[model samples]
Target: MLIILTMVLFALALSTIVMFISSLLSKKTIIDREKSSPFECGFDPKGSARLPFSLRFFLIAIIFLIFDVEITLLLPLVVVTKLTFIKTWVITGTFFLLILLAGLYHEWNQGALDWSS
Candidate 1:
């Protein structure tokens, strides 16, 4: 009990000290008109704020996100393959593959995977 209390107090003190040092070492910068101006692709300001963007950019981003999430879901299975539920894991993996292939086929049919004009 006493040891835990001491540890908590020590952690609090350490964090406070680190924060104080960081604050002292940091430089404060004032925001001016140029700094506050809207930035786009590192270029000068363009037309109105309601300017339209290419839908191809959005489609590519969404496809990348879908594949990214699929890879994330596959990582855990790779790590825990030695467990007792190997057959269950295999079935789950096959299901995931089927879903991924179906999505790929759909994208191909919709011309979403084509980069050439």
Candidate 2:
């Protein structure tokens, strides 16, 4: 208990010292101007902030998120397979492949994957 307490205190002290030193060494520069505007595209700002975004952008974003999450789920399966001898990895891989293929087919059929449209 004493060792853990000592370690925690040491870590806290170390972190605080590092943070203080970093802040002290950092330059305090805040040059606020037109360049720091929200729309830094150089083009004149137009329309309201509540402008409706493209549905195609949302659709693509959703599809990308779905695939990203699928990849995240696969990472755990992959790590577990490396640690233990399990045939479940094969099943999971096949399931993921099938689902991905189906999603691709669906997207292709719906013309959502096509950018030229």
Candidate 3:
């Protein structure tokens, strides 16, 4: 136990020393405007680089991600069914499905599922 503790402490101290040395050597003293600005053909930019993103598309994507994760969670239950009793598994699965349905209903009622504005 003493040897393990000593080795862990040694590793921690070594990592700290290496990180300190690397940080000290990596300091940047030069700051130039050309390096910071987006590259153009020796001319100022015409417009902002970032374009506006669609809020509806973002909402749809979030909904897709949430449902995708729920499906993954549900998939594992099929494998576990053989190991457990059928009644318990069915109850658990049904409860989870009810929660997912409730969330879907809430999103629909709130008009988040509607694409047409």
Clashes per model (N, Cα, C within 3 A): 0, 0, 0
Candidate 3 accuracy as TM-score: 0.54
CA RMSD, predictions in order: 6.8, 7.8, 9.8
lDDT of 2 by residue, 1-117 (tens): 999999999999999999999999976666454445567223335555566666787788788999898888778877787888678787877798799889989998998977667
For model 1, residues 13-43, the per-residue Cα lDDT tens digits are 9999999999998765765556778897545
**Winner by lDDT:** 3
- What would the TM-score be for candidate 1 when compared with the true structure? 0.59
Tens-place lDDT digits, model 3, residues 8-97: 999999999999999898755555554676765344465665656678888998999999999999998988887776888889999999
User: Model 2 — which ten-residue stretch has the worst lDDT?
Assistant: 40-49
Task: Please identify which of the two predictions, 1 or 2, would achieve the higher lDDT against the true structure.
Answer: 1
Model 3 worst lDDT window (10 residues)? 40-49
Ranking by TM-score: 1, 2, 3
Q: How many clashes does the backbone of model 2 have?
A: 0
Best by TM-score: 1
Which parts of model 2 have CA positions greater than 4 angstroms off?
1-32, 39-46, 50-52
Q: Which portions of model 3 show Cα errors greater than 4 Å?
A: 1-47
